[model samples]
Every structure is written in structure tokens, then in C-alpha cells.
Target: MMNRHQLPDTLLMGYAAGALPEAFNVVIATHVSLSDEARARLAAFEAVGGAVLDDDAAEMAEDSFDRMMARLDMLPQANARVTEAAEGIFPAPLADYVHRDGRSIRWRSIGAGVKQAILRTDGRASVRLLRIPAGQAVPDHGHRGTELTLVLQGAFFDGNKRYGRGDIEVANEETEHTPIAEAGEDCICLAATDAPLRFKSLIPRLAQPFFRI
Candidate 1:
């Protein structure tokens, strides 16, 4: 029952094909864990991929069959439980990375009643959790590359739209807006970015290097 927003079709397809960067994959996987509709859509893409493979005309080597079976045996079981470390707020895929209760998260202050915890990710892109107090506003900024942000709890309004739990905001260099958490509750978001943000304010621009936002 997703009510606010959904991942874009391009992102969904890239995730299904395993072609996204590690940071992007993490965001997609976590969103899928929370949205049954996303899961079904991803399954459809996988089915189409399988059908295409079945129609492949190239002949396989004699040892290919045995090697494939051996590889299957080496793969971990799909039903293995994610760690019990995370509170229910985190979906299982994200829980695997945090590996601790939400309250235990070490948050770093980023001014203006906002806090953040950077999550270790592969390559140039980065993933992190952000907590913004109710009514607080994130600095007005645009993206240098791409940014995918998923709301895990509460809500925020970014001038153009309101995003609540399970909503994802996809932004690129062309987009810039000040996101303000709604009045009643703090907004918790899982965000991934491929490059440094483009800040408008002089103070934010100066602090950008130190905060790595």
C-alpha cells in the first residue's frame, strides 16, 4: 500500500538487471523490502530476463552445465535470516548494513537540528541515514550527479511534493529544493548520492567539504 511515490522505472530495471552501482543497489533493495508492489515489478523483470536466456541460440560448452550446478551449490541459501541487530524501522537489506538498533546509531550533527550517519558503501557513491527534526529544513541544494532518497519514517515536504514513509525522491543536477520535515514527526531517510551536492548558500558551500554532504 504505497501511497506517496515509487521508484522510477529506469531504476527498477537497472536494479533487476544488477547493473546499478552498489550504493544505488542498496537503496533499491531496501525500498523493495518495504514495498510489495516494487517486489512484484522486479520479479516481472527477472522473469523476462529468464525467458530471454532460455531463447539464447549459442551452444554451451560441455563443462558449462556442471560448472553452473557447482556455482549454485556454492551460493548461500535465500532464506537465511538478516541479523537481529536492527529495530523494525529498517528493512532487512538495510538492517544487514546497520547491524544495530536504531537508537544505538552514532549520529553526527550537521547543523539546523539535523543528524546523519554515513554508511560504508562501495565505489565513489555513498549511502547514509539522515534524521531531521520536525519542521527543520535541509539546506537548499541541487545534485552534481544523481541522488536517490527513500523515506523510512515520518514525512517531508520539498516545496514541490510531500513524501511520507515508503516514498522515494529521485533528483539529478536539474533539481534543487529545500526539504522540510513535517511538523508532527522527525523525518528519517535513507539516501544515496553519486557526487557532492551543489549548495546555494555560501555557508553550506563552505561546510560541504567538512560534512561531505
Candidate 2:
């Protein structure tokens, strides 16, 4: 019900400007759906972008408003992408990529009661949904690049802090930790990483290439 972490303004601005990679975009879009603060910030960023564009453009024609409305109407709902509505555990934007029903998803077991479903993306980054059984701990790992993880259900705690539903944890090359899910319910996260993780465990290191985690 409450979020302790959210995307920074720079990242939200990148999302508003459509400058983020598709994998990251999915995480933002899904997070925005769950966060009112993020939604408001995104709207503010979009408004600034719109104002900038308007100031640079030539004088508006008399029918510009109508024309724009018509264009928007002609576009697909997904293309407009103004907001992500809650559908199931997956928000509207994420639902477009995979089945809302968890049972239908093709999840691959990673290890230690952890499973993942990799989502197809443009390859600028990798996107995956991670499901960790309650009380299970993911192996200790360090990031080689940026990692964005948005909790969709339940919660997880690194040694330092806990991230619950609607909270997004941003980690970079300098970060390293082991995340364990809270008791009672499984933790589901939408995660995007620009580079492969550096697992400390020998077994996970050997399996990294095969799982692409």
C-alpha cells in the first residue's frame, strides 16, 4: 500500500521523453500505474516537453486542436500510452507483453524456489519477471550495469532495506547484495538490466550464460 522507493526525476524524465530503452520503459510504465506520485511527476514532465515543443513550433493553425484530436483517435490505444491501468497483477502496459494470468506464463526455474519469465524486448536491455518464494533468498550478486527492479507483489529485503509493492529499487555497478522475499506471500518483480549480473556463487556464475540473468 505504501512505496518507500520511486524512480528519480531524471529517469522519469527519460521515460516521458521516450528516451529510455523498451525494457526500462516497461518497468516505469508498470510502476507509474501503481504510484500516484510517479503519475503526477510523469504528467509534469510531459507537460514541460509539450510546452517546449509548442514554443519551438510555428504558429498553430485554426484547426490544430481538432486535427490533433483526430490523430489521437486514429492511433491505437497502446500507442497513445498516456497511462497504465491495473488489469491483474500485471498492469495494462505489461499485460500487452504477456498473459495477465500467472499460470499461463512460461516461467523457467532458476533455483532455490526462484522462477523467471523473460520478456521480449529490443535488446537495449533485458526485461524479466522474477518470482521468489517467500523466505527464499536470491544469490548474492553485483551489478555490472544498471538494474531497475519494480516490485509488483509482496516484498523483498536486501541487507540494507526493504522494497515492497510499488517500490522500485535502482542499483548500479557499485551495488551488491542478496535479496530475500518476505514471509507469507511470494515476491514478484519486474526487472530490467542493461548488463548481466556478477554472481558471487560458483554455481550461479556457471549458469548465468544459460539463464541470461
Measured over all alpha carbons after superposition, the RMSD of each candidate to the real structure, in angstroms, is 4.0, 4.8
Candidate 2 local lDDT, residue 62: 96
Q: Model 1: what TM-score?
A: 0.84
Over 13-75, each residue of candidate 2 has an lDDT whose tens digit, in order, gives 999999989999999988998899999999999998999888865768999999998898677
Candidate 1 residue spans exceeding 4 A from truth: 1-4, 57-87, 100-103
TM-score of each candidate? Answer: 0.84, 0.84
RMSD of 2: 4.8
lDDT of 2 at 166: 87
State which candidate has the highest lDDT: 2
User: For model 1, how big is the CA root-mean-square deviation?
Assistant: 4.0
Candidate 1 CA-lDDT value:
0.84
Q: In model 2, what is the error at residue 46, expressed in angstroms?
A: 0.9
User: Considering summed lDDT, which 10 consecutive residues are worst modelled in model 2?
Assistant: 77-86
**Residue clash pairs of candidate 2:** none
